[model samples]
Target chain A: MNQDKMGKGEQSRARLLQAAAVQFAAVGYHRTRVSDIVRQAGLTQAAFYLYFPSKESLYQELMDGFFQKLWELSDAGGKVTPLARHEVRDRMKENLLELFRFFARMPEQTRIVLTGAEEREELHRKLTSIVSANLRKNQEAGHVRPELSVEVAAESMLAVVQRLTVRFLLSGERTAEQLAEDAAALLAKGILQADRTKEE
Target chain B: MNQDKMGKGEQSRARLLQAAAVQFAAVGYHRTRVSDIVRQAGLTQAAFYLYFPSKESLYQELMDGFFQKLWELSDAGGKVTPLARHEVRDRMKENLLELFRFFARMPEQTRIVLTGAEEREELHRKLTSIVSANLRKNQEAGHVRPELSVEVAAESMLAVVQRLTVRFLLSGERTAEQLAEDAAALLAKGILQADRTKEE
Candidate 1:
C-alpha cells in the first residue's frame, strides 16, 4: 500500500541520519561523502537524497535535532521542587548527570552535534533558540540568580558542560559521571568556602 | 653572510607560521593549504617546507606555541588581599577575563589548537603540565587549597573559558571583551546564590 511504502521510507531515512551522524562526527563534515554515508547505512546513494536535499542540509538537520533533544530532555519534568537547597541541588545534579550519561553513551552523536557547523544562519538561530528558551524557563523558576542575564547564565552553563565533557572524553582522565556530579556540586556550592562540612 | 641567510630564513619561517595560524583558524585545518599559507605570507612554497615539513607539522608547532604561551601567562602574581570576599571573587574574575582576552585576540590560533583529536596525547601531557605547574605555584604560596587536586581544578577552569569562547565566537553574539568579563565573573562566582560576602 502507499502508507506502507511511506513507513518504509521513513525508517530508511532515520537509519541514514544515524549513520551520517557517526561518520560526520568521526571524520568531520568536509571529509564525509554521500556514498560513504549510504554505504554505512546499508542503503543506496539515492536513498540519501530521498531524505536530505544535500549534505549541508543534512548537517543542519543533525545539529537542529541535537539541541532540540537536549532542550526537550532538560525541560521535561523540569523545575526543582522548592525543597531544601541541597535537595534541589540533588535534583539538578541528577538531571545534569542524566544528560552526561546520554553523552557518554552516544559519544559519536555528541561529537557530531557539538563540532558540526554549517554555513547557515537559520540552523544557528534554531540552536540559539533551544539554548535561550531553556534559559528563560530556568529564570522564570527562579532557579538561577536574577541578577545575571538569562542568556549569559544559560550559555555559560552550556559552555562549561560542553568543554568538561570534551576533556573527559578526549583526555580519558575522568569518568563522565564523576565530572557531571562534581560540576553540579561546585556550581551549587558557590565560590567562597562555607561552614558546611564539604570543603569549598 | 651565512648568518644573514640564517636570519632571513628564520624571518620567512615566522611569517609562514603566522599566516598558517590565521588561515587554519579561519578556514579550519583541513581547508588550509600550503600554497595559500605561502601566498599569504608573501613567500614561496619552497620556503614554507624549508621551515616546516608539512601543513600538519606546522599545525603541531602552532599548537605547541599556544600551550607554551598559556603556561607563561597562567601566573596569578599574588593572592587577593583579604579585604572583601567580593574582592577575591573580583580578582579571580579579572584573571579569567585577561586570559580569555589573550585567546580571543588570536581566534584563529585558538580554533586550530582547540579543534584537534586524541592522537595528540603528547600535547595533552604538555598542557596538563602547564596547569599543574601553575597550581603548584599557587599552593606553595598558600593561595590554593592543598587538598584539592590541581589537575582537575586547572582543567575545569580551562574547560569553562575555552567552551565559552567557542560559543562566543561561533555564535557571533557576545563581543570578546564582554564574554571574557562575564565568563570571568561566572567562573569566580561558580554559579551559586550563596553569600560570598561572608568571605570578606
Candidate 2:
C-alpha cells in the first residue's frame, strides 16, 4: 500500500481519481472538464484518456468507488444476534460511526454522490435492497420485531442515515461518534417513552 | 374548483400547468420545450407566455405547489397531546395518510419533485425544521422521549416519509391506508420488541 511501491500507471490512475474528486466537488460535474482534471493531476490528456474514456466516466468511477465502499460497510454489521440492551445500542452506533467516518474520509466523493446519485434510481433501489436484506436477517435472528415490514424499515433507516450524514456530519455540527450515538439511541427505542401512550 | 366555473385566463393557466407537469415528467426538463407544452395544452405559444414566462418557470411553479401542499400537511400534524395508545398511532397514521394522498392526487408533480427536489437543499432543511419543531412540541408535551434529539428524529421522519412515497405509494405497490398504518405502528413503537434485548 506504500506510495513508492505503486507502479507508474497505478500511481497515475490514483492521481487522476483524486484530482477528479477534488475538481468535481469544487466546480461541480458540469463545469469540471477533462482538461481541468488532467492539469490538476499534473498529467497530460493522453494520460487521462488512458485511465478514463471521458470526464463523465471518470466521475462515474469516483461515484462507484464511494458506493462500493458503502456496500462493503453494509455487510460489516455482521449477523445481528440478540444482545444485551447496551450491546445492541453499541453495535448500532458502531455501524453508523463507520458510515460517518467513510463520509469524513471521502468528503469530495460524498459531495459528488450526494448531488448526482439521486437521479440514479437503480443505485437507490440497490442500496435499499442490501439494507432490507440485512434487516430481514435481523428479523429472523429475533433481534428485530417479527411482524415489521423489513422493506419499509430498511428504506426508513436509509432515509435517516442519509439525512444525518448531510445535515449533521457534513455540516460539522456533530462528530461521527456523537451523531452515531444519538441516531442509534433514537432508532433503537424510537421516540416513544415506555407505556406513556400504551393502548387502553 | 370546477373547471367549467373557471374564467378564460384561469382556464388557460390551469391548462398550461397541467401540460407542463406531464411534459416535464415525460421527457425531463432539458428535453421538454415550450412548444411541446403549449401544443399539449391546446393553446397558442402566446397564451403560454401569458401564463408562464418560460418552461423552467412553469416547472418551478409545479414543484412549488407540491412542496407548499406538503408544508401545509406538516402543520396539520397538530399538537401532540397525551392520548390513548391507539389514538397516538391513529393520529400518526392520519398525518401520513394525508401525505400519501397528496402524492396520489398529484402523481406528475410527485414524479418531477422526486427526480429533481434533492437539489433544493433549502426545501429539505425547511421541511426538516418544520417536522423537528413538531417533534419538539411533542417532547414538551411529554409524549416523546425527552432525551431523543428532535432534530435528528425530524430529519429521519422526513426521510422515511419521502422514501415510502416514492417507492410503494407512487408505484402502487401499497395503498395509502396500508402505508400509513405500517409507518404509524413502526414510528410509534419502533422495531425492537419489548425487553427482547434488554441488558442482562
Candidate 3:
C-alpha cells in the first residue's frame, strides 16, 4: 500500500519536526544535534536519516516552514482591499494582531527565527523588502507619511515587531491582542507629543 | 627590563584581539578556533595562552569592550542637561548619531553584538532596561507621550536602531548623520498622517 506508507512517513516527519523545534529552542541551533532530536522524538537514528540527510537540512526545513507561514500571512494582509485613510489603521492593527497570534502559537519557532541564523538572513531580507514595497504602495496612496524612507520605515517596523514579540509576547507578559493594539497605536501616533512644535 | 616585557605582552594581546575580531566577523563565533586566531595574530599558542586562557575568555573580552564603550556613550547622553522640549529631539538625534559613529568604527564588533550570541543576550537585556528607565524619566517630565508604555517604546526604539545600523550603516548606504536625523523624525512624528481623526 504505497499510500499507507506515505501517510506513515508524513507522520514520522511531523514528529521529528516537533522534537527539533523543542530542542532548537531550548539549546539553540549550533548546540543541537541530530541525536538529541531523534531521542526527543522517540525515533531511531535510521528514521531521522530517512527524513533528513543532515541536521542542517532539518534546521533548514524548520526555518522554511516558519518563513512560509509568515509570507502567507503577509500575502493575505496585502490582498485586503485598500481602505479609507481613517480605516487603514484599524486594518493594519488587526493584521498585526493576527501576526502576533501566529507567533504566540509557536514561541519556540519564534525563538529560532529570531536567533540570527545565517541562512534565515535571506528570509529577513525578503520580508523587509516586501514590507518596504507595501509601505511604498501605501505612501503612493497617500495613506502613510510621504517624507519617511519606505525602506528604513519597513526595517524599523519589522525591528519593532520582532523585538516586542520575542521580549514580551513570548514571555506571556501581555496577550498578542494587547501588544498589537499598543504597537499599532505607537506606530500610528508616535511617542512624541502631538501639540509640540516640530523642530530640527 | 620588567616594564619592557610588560609592554610587549600588552602589544601581543592587542594583536590577538584584532585578529580574533576579523575571524569572528568573517566566519562566526562558533566556527572560529583559537588556532586560527593565534595564526592570524602571528603569535604562538604559548603566547595566546599567556594572555587569555581560552577562546571563550577572548570572546568575553571583546564583548566587554563593546558594551563598555556603549555604556560610556549612553552615560554621556544621560548627563546632557534636560533640554528645552523643542530641543530634546535634536539632542536625541545627536546622541544616536554619535552611537552610530561608534558602530561605524567597528562594524565587526557590531556584527558580534547583533549575532545573538547566548552571552550577549544578557547585555542586550541590560541595554533595553537602561533605555526603558530613561524613557520613563522623560515620560514623567511630560517630554514624551504619556499614553505609550515606556518599556515597549524603549524596546522598539532599540530594535529600530539595531536593524538600521546593521542593514544600512554597516553597508555604507547611509551616514550616521542622515540615519539619525531621519530616525529621529520618524520616532517623533511616526508613519501616520498628522491630521487623521483618532480612531480605534
Best by TM-score: 2
* CAPRI grade, predicted model 3: acceptable
Which one wins on DockQ?
A: 2
Query: What lDDT would candidate 3 get against the real structure?
Result: 0.78
Ranked by lDDT, top first: 3, 2, 1
**Poorest stretch of ten by lDDT in candidate 2 chain B:** B191-200
Candidate 2 ranges beyond 4 A from true positions: A1-15, A26-31, A42-68, A81-89, A190-200, B1-14, B26-32, B46-68, B81-87, B117-119, B190-200
Q: What ranking emerges by TM-score with the best candidate at the front?
A: 2, 3, 1
Per-residue CA lDDT of model 1 for B117-198, tens digit only, reads 4323455466667666766665564455554556656666666666666767645677766765666555544431233345
lDDT string, candidate 3, B47-106, tens digits: 999999899999989878788898776554354336556566667778888988999998
Per-chain TM-score of chain A in candidate 3 equals 0.80
Residue B174's lDDT in candidate 1: 70
TM-score of each: 0.62, 0.79, 0.77
Question: Compared with the true structure, what per-residue lDDT tens digits does model 2 show for residues B131-150?
Answer: 88877776676566677788
Q: Candidate 2 chain A: worst 10 consecutive residues by lDDT?
A: A191-200
Clashes of each: 1, 0, 0
Report the lDDT tens digits of candidate 3 across residue range A1-200.
Answer: 34366687888898898899999888788889898999999999999999999998988888787788888766543543376556666777888898999999988888877754744687688888888777777777666676778788888888898889988998899899988987887775542123233321
User: Residue A11, candidate 1: how far off, in angstroms?
Assistant: 15
